[model samples]
Target: MTIPTPPPGPEPLRETIARHGLDARKALGQHFLLDPGITARIAGLAGDLAGQNVVEVGPGPGGLTRALLDSEAGRVVAVEVDTRAVAIITELASRAGGRLEVIEADAMRLDLTTLCPAPRQVIANLPYNVGTPLLVGWLRQAAAWTRLTLMFQQEVAERICAAPGSAHYGRLGVLAQWTCRCGVLMHIPPGAFSPPPKVHSAVVGLIPHAHQPDAALFRAMEQVTAAAFGQRRKMLRGALKPLGGESLLAEAGIDGSRRAETLDIAEFDRLARLHMRRAAA
Candidate 1:
């Protein structure tokens, strides 16, 4: 017997998850977004999603998935790790008139740059556990995306857009700002999630800058930031010891006494460049 289709809109989110006996599993960081209004607004932040390819990570119960499809996005390629949600995503895809594609693959393992169509925007309420790592991967391949509208824990969101001298400014801030123009799009409370997360969440928008340095420079920044922030309490002179400490700071034209959180993206770029010089020498 052919089963009848459910009515459209946000109700399907709750119904689908309930019908499938799916609960938000903590291990997967699965806090499903049941509010379609909020999801719609998040999709809206992508700016004229119509005729644009969108990559959605972790489409639990197809809530945001439906929002993206309804926004008239040209196509949506949802990469989901949870096999349980596949059926729900497939249902959404079927309704999308061949515009939606669901890949039962881990977002972290999949390089979206090689996977999705060009002129793509990534919009998702990212699984909290893997959000930061996934974002780092994307930023490393920033050229592939037109924009990234992603959700992360409020703290992480702040860190991504934090300026130098701010308490949240550190490795993530430096790395994110190094390659993209980052901002907090909207703040979501813990209550917004089905099983409320311990902390608030925020949606962030990252548009790649015109002048991202080469891979080598990125690596250099990674190395330098890792070392500096690894021992953040210590001054640059002490923290960057393996890379010549005070001398390295001098070579970069930075003060050896400065701390990691005080350095902006430009300073980090300079430090990365200097680190590369040291490696070459």
Candidate 2:
């Protein structure tokens, strides 16, 4: 199908909702982002979507779908768990000129790298309930995408981009920062949705590292971070006891007295590497 050229004038999303009898379904964790301007801004942040394969998650009622198609994006493969929403987005695909493919499945279950052409990038306003789990799954396969521009509750966004020693810093911050450069792009007020969520939302982007820390080291870092931040208030010597306490810190040349939040990415990597060498031995 040829990509549908958006006709001149407004797309009339609200009118479409009224005509189609669409309402956000809480069962699906569906809160449709309703602002056209916000949609346009999100698509633009993807950085030259033209000819790039883009993946969008939870394309409820096609708000962001229309924006992505209007932009220069070459192709968009949207995965939606809600079957009802999938039907609506399929119509969006036709209007999108064959450039949009609607996949009726959970984003967490799909293999993004295998679904689209290379140079893939993910851009979406994720369903709130499944956002963090989906993100952690994607991070596990970070090499699959060139970049990702995603919208999440502001709290999750903070966790992803949090600085070391900050209150928000934890396993999430360590895992995200370990492989990618991430930052918040925009703050979306709660009022911008059909059924506005309780908390505000934000857009954040991730650009994966060109060369990651060693694979074994990276895994060990994740393990160490999980143990440390899983008990954040405890001293590192106590928190990281699962990975061998003072001996692990000593081998990594780090001070065991420090708390988890105080260690930066380099120190995390150092611990990971130390764990790796010991495992190899």
| Best-performing candidate as measured by lDDT | 1
lDDT of candidate 2 at residue 123, scale 0 to 100: 96
- Give TM per candidate: 0.95, 0.92
| Clashes in predicted model 1 | 0
Q: How well is each residue in 211-260 modelled by candidate 1, as lDDT tens digits? A: 77778878888899999999989999999998889888897899998899
Q: Which ten residues in a row have the lowest lDDT in candidate 2?
A: 1-10
lDDT of 1: 0.88
Residue by residue across 218-278, what tens digits does model 2's lDDT show?
Answer: 6777788889888878999998887889999998888888999999988988888887787
The TM-score obtained by model 2 is 0.92
Show how many residue pairs clash in every candidate, following the order shown.
Answer: 0, 4
Model 1: residue 221 alpha-carbon error in angstroms: 0.5
